[model samples]
Target chain A: MYTKLALLIFIFMSKLSASVVTTLPEFAWIVHNLNPDTKVINLLQGNEDPHFVDASPSFVFKVAKAKLLIKNGMQLEMGWLPVVTQQSGNEAVQLGGKGHCDASQNVNKVGVIANYDRSMGDVHPVGNPHYTLSLVEMKSVIKTIAKCMERVGLEYSKDKYTELLAKFDAQIANVKKLLKPIKMKKFMVYHTEFNYFLRDFDLISVGSLEEVPGVLPSAVYLAKTAKKAMDEKVSLVLASNVSPERYLNKFKDISSINYVKAQMHPLSSDDYLKHYENFINELVDNVSL
Target chain B: MRLILLMFLLVTSAFAQNNNLQLINWFAGADIVASGDNLDQGADKENHLNDGMLVREFEFSAVSQIDQTWQGILTLAYHNELQAEEEHLEVHEAMLFSSKLLPMANVKIGKFFLGFGRLNRFHRHDWIFTEAPLVQKSFFGNEGVKDTGFEYTRLLGGALNWKLTVGLTSGGEFKHGEAHEEEGEEEHDHGGNPAPYEPTRYLRASNFIEFSTIEGIESGVSYVERRDGEGTRSSYAGLDLIYKKRVNQYIDRLVQFEVWQRTTKEMGEESFQDLGAYLYFEKGLNRHHGLGLRFDFYLPADLEEEEDHDEHGHSSIDGITPMSNYHAISLSYNYYNSEFMRTRFTLEHHNGVDVEEEEESFQRAHLQFVFNIGAHPAHVY
Candidate 1:
């Protein structure tokens, strides 16, 4: 009976030791990709906006058990993530520590609307925080995630992380090369979320339909927009899958413009590679001279 | 019903083609508020929608980017004052934007919300509260918050980032209301006389005023001085210093300070500019629940009052009049069921002190539940 109890204790300790924690969905993707053997508990999901996530009790419990905690810095999760970390009483994943990695660092963010204030309808006051979508940006984020994991003394499958990261880099480079040939590098987007992606790909984003982030446009405004799109001879009207469709139909018949949807946030199981491949393929398919 | 059917047809037609233009993102929400005045100044208590108290708003917005440099957004909204029995339905915002002009700068020349103060430029759907702050609402008025304008924004410097923005607006129209008169006039009064013989006091123009009446230019510069540290543990410190000045020839000089910070758990300091500065703090108790506290003190500039005669040879005081200094403290808790749905409860206290009268204190409690029906871009910053 003593031997059995000792074995049970060992097993429980081992299980507890095996747990790894990650902040932000991008880091979760990297951890899952790098070490399939380790169970990764993701603090945030892609479907929900990470900027204003509500910190719940379960989230604190998860943080307490985490050996590794990764976060997107640059004030992206300022609203809730800090509170969760503080309440968890886990000093391992504290800010400026090895546990936190802001993915926005070192990425060339283009078309970042400057002087952004609260009035601009929930725009990022800092540089673009959605750097995870760009392959070049993703590489930087992966490197930081790997470094954070290493700090926690967790053995990451370096071979797998590097392999996946290299493949993703090549895939992104190929897409960039493919897009280079297209003379019309200018496009329109529904919102300001795609600044980093557009900058990485050397694409120009001209305008947005809504006057502000969440406010709807009027018919008079739509008519004026249609006229502008026609006059500018805009090549593509870029939108996201999450945005609405009613207002975009006015430009469908216009030969000068083609509507394309760019996925700002990946909500599916597809990693960065699959998502970008699908995005680029859709872009090439829809956007043509 | 016909409009809804038309919208449905338009959406269906696009969806059938597997086109990007045919997406429909819709969201609807209502606010339930209860407030009482200590003075009991005859303010109505019944829930009425048109008075801008209890509101129900439905918004539908669509975005289709034509290409890299051009994009368009079309948004329509229906707002109703549930208690006031007034409804407003219109296509609120539709603009096509482009950034192909320069590498570091983007020029937006369309009918868009002119970037003004922090609150004026943001969308109501994304705000923590239904109404804007008192300062913004009282000063800018409703339409003054947005106008037909041209904006130029550009980023400069690498290591030390600096942003500059300049915009010109055609100014916004003021809400019209009839001037008060003595209670004795039966049929109509012209120039304070209860007789039709009084000549029309200098034939006034129609109710609709021209835009040139309030045309103005607003410009501002912001510097984000950030020092990158070892990681989040050391407390990523950054200073967002902004100076904005607007002049319209009518009245001038409005400035605001909006500074805050986020620190990691190890930093130990959660206070945001607590040392004689505007600040607020929000912390999550758990993944599903969070609490936020905000204390705001509005110190308006001193007023310069002058007594002047009106065009009709009537004597009246005309000039900058002192507005009440308002202090507000708000406590809010949020319950997030999912990304698209959430319930929030806010208790707010307002201490409004007029220059002459004693300070008045009021307490307001608001409960709101929002369920996003369609897809929208997540808040980035």
Candidate 2:
């Protein structure tokens, strides 16, 4: 009976461990691309907003036992991760520590809006925090993840990270070359989050439909924006699929302006190249006018 | 007053006459609250009975753009305080705000609430609870809602997400109750001086002299001096900074710091300084929950010299004793029910400093329900 109870406990622990790693997108990506035997227990899905997440009570339990912790640095997770680390007493994930990684470190930032001001709307003041959209930057982030994987003494395919990086580079370069011939550089967007991607492809952001972050434009504000779009002869009204449609409806009269939805968040799938290819193709199709 | 109302009606009617002006949207909402307090034994503790009261608040706001470069907002509020059988009504906030005065800057002017502290800038109706933090309530007061002032905000740099703001303000504090001669009667009767008491008879409504001495009334008062008119000479200046960043795609962090100073020339004495500073950090673990930590410090210039007691033996200084230094740590669980409602449970620890030796540390648990009646996307800069 004693031996049977011990075996049951061992099985429970392994199952729990597998669930924890699979919950996070980055870890899931790592597991998908590098190790089939490794189990991810509980990683966050990409559909959720990361800024205001609830660190589940079980997270402390997981982090307390975790051998490796991966995160996006640059003060992004400062709100809840620190508390989790502290509660779990995990020094590995502490700031500036070995288990920590900032995917942005070596990533190539693109389409950074020049002279972007906070007063313009809810715009990213920094060059662009959304560097994940660029295949080149995504490759850098993957390399950083691979380094973390190595630190944990996990046996990962030696060339997997490198192979992924090369593939993304070639694919992104081709897209960049293809987009180079487009003459329409100026576009309007509902939000300013796309600055990095647009700048990389030489797109010019003329204005946005929303007056500020999280706020819809008042009628008067919308009218002025519509007038400005007409005045500037902008060709595209870029937006997000998740955003409200009322604000973009005003641009319908402008035949040249086409509404395009762009994804700004990361995805859970490990197929980064497939996602980028589809995204870029959609963007090109929308602006083909 | 009737004519003013008539003129307002005419202007609104004319505005409505233009179908184009009718395109603007408007929203309104309110909350009801009940509160009770227990005061420790003290010389003035007798008046601090366990009190219960109800308050109803109403607000209306509109946003519109003037041409492509300018955006405007107009908001007005009304509040009614009811205690037992009595009810009182007052204007809460009335103001106009404009953005894009320049390509990268926004300006807010008129009688509007100033964003001196994080809590001060948040609309009361949107608060998690009916009451504000005790420190904020005691220092700023009810109807500390708005000041007649102008503020300018600018966003600088995109990669760094740095933001800055500067403001100039006309300071006139508002208090609940009708301003009248009867309000001064307590001071005049206690002094038994008819000459000083005489001013009460002719005092205009809401224009009672503030310095009148009543034997034991502990009134929270702030003085604003204006060079050109009553309450006009007092001036205030402020600065604010905000920094935010996303860590990977799952975590977000924000840091906000602010400092403000106000100066007023006393009727017959020296000018005094009212200084305040605040720092706060918020982290978003994911989209629905966050944790916040905050520190605040305030210093009032005219501390009564315990030795300088008047013949009548009353404290002359009108402000609450400075908090000197205060800090709060909060763990918040936010449930985004929808675009219009959010519920948050915050466990907060408050530490107070530099008060009477007998005062103890202040702490409490706050569960807040935030009702976002409307949202204009947050200006991210």
Candidate 3:
């Protein structure tokens, strides 16, 4: 009886130690790879748009118990994550707390506006937050996440993070080489979510179907975008799984440009590297020089 | 080379400090309404929903993480009082909050919306409908329960997502009794007592559970009590439920239901109880459009009937229609232009049951325009 009680206590104590929570599944996948021993919880489990998370009670429950919290930052999770973390009453993961990690701290950013207002639509003040679409930018976030793990006293292999960063660098190089033939292909996107990915591969984005970030474009704006695509000889119209399909079909019907919808963000799966490789293969398979 | 390196370090540190100082944010919002009612005769104070347009409410707010351990929120509002034919500026909320003061607890101090019923805590602009439901308007007045208070919320992390909140408030601004007027109180009289406020205490326990991958439900129980210096006491108990079904990213469904019971007793009078309830349902057609419906019901305590009868043989209660039971149904269509703006059109029908005969029924139509600018954090789910 004494031994059994001791074992139960040990199990409870182990459960209370250094659990991590991330706002996005991609971050969780990276954390699990870097620290296999740490128990990680992901707030977004499906293809729900990161911009409009529900901040449900289950998310608060997970955040309340986590010792460390990670977010993509740069206002990507601005609408929901702050309220969940605040309601969690977990000081360790609150804004200025030692266990809080913003993965966009040192990333290379694009689409930063010096002076902005609501008239410009839902634009981030700290630049575009879709840097996760680029593996090169994600290397910087991996370093930030690793530092946060160390601060939380979680056991993580430094060599693993370094190896992961090197692997990302190699993949980025190889993809760029494979897509060299279509480096300057002009394309239009449903949303600006793929700006970082296009920038990484040296592709030219003529315009977007959505003039404003989250709002559907007016017919006048759509006509102008289509005319611009036709004039620029745009190769393809790019979209994501989260983009509105009906509007994409409307734009395709008007512009006569076929769209290739990709999954820029990873789902709740451990094989995130496969997602990246599959995305690269889809681009090569769809676009022509 | 070493001096240049030192200067670069100094510049970087200064830049970081400047960024920290910019964390304080200020935002503003406005709600304008164009309303029309068919009621021929009513006092302005009794029914403030007029047949004209008005800038119903305008608010400015500031929020800041004061430091690593404290956060502050301040909101000021200017609203047109159609009853008084003037615009009044009011402080909606000014509070300092901290989560680091205690383990698994969040503390808030200063004036704020009381931690009570589900709809009571949300600001009018955040509500789905343009006007308060009949039950909410009768029990908590148009704005719902807001007071100067200290609130402590405890996050009891468990499988059921349990949370508890307790608040003690100075109820100087507590307002009620518009629809269910007290005895001897004249019509067109506004409510809410001034200074020397009575002390109000409230407690609420909330729990949430996910039934499936796409369905989530949250339920809460709340209780509040207040004692006036004049020996009048009031107590309220409430239950609220919110359910959400996420069919897709653009299409979802929401159902909200609430029931409240209030008991009031004077120094020498027998206690009287009032019951109120509301059920709301909304279906999202897509990202931009939604349809919503709400049903409201309120039953007031017993009233004494006057001995005299009118020429039409209709009984009278204090020379007025005895609206013992009241219910209303509202249907609304909402258009979300973007994250910053929304337009809503609402149609409502109000019916009352009299002790002897059927009280008059009325219809109302309202169009509301709500817009926000600057930096405003989204409200919690």
On DockQ, the candidate that comes out on top is: 3
Residue B137 C-alpha lDDT in model 3? 65
Model 3 lDDT per residue over B1-381, tens place:
224335534644574477553676767899999988766564322443557889988887778877777888877776773323555555678899887788678898998888778888788888878887766765676666777879999987555778999999876656532222233443221243334336889999999987643478999999999866455677899999988886444437899998999887666777777788999999989878999999988776664533221211111211223347777899999997877789999998877765555565778888999999777776677
Model 1 / residue B160 / CA error / Å? 47
Once fitted onto the true fold, the runs of candidate 1 whose alpha carbons sit more than 4 angstroms away are: A1-18, A110-116, A180-185, A213-220, A246-258, B1-381
**Total clashing pairs for each candidate:** 66, 63, 0
lDDT tens string, model 1, A199-233? 67778666776666644456777667767766766
* TM-score head-to-head 1 vs 2, winner: 2
Per-residue lDDT over A194-251 for candidate 2, one digit per residue giving the tens place of the 0 to 100 score = 6666766777778878777645667888778878887887767777654556557655
Please give the TM-score that candidate 3 achieves against the real structure.
0.87
Docking class of 3: acceptable
Candidates ranked by lDDT: 3, 1, 2
Candidate 2 is graded, for docking, as incorrect
Two-chain DockQ for each candidate model:
0.02, 0.02, 0.38
True contacts kept of 1: 0.00
Q: Residues A142-175, candidate 3, lDDT per residue (tens digit)?
A: 8889888888898788888888888888888888
What TM-score goes with each of the models?
0.42, 0.43, 0.87
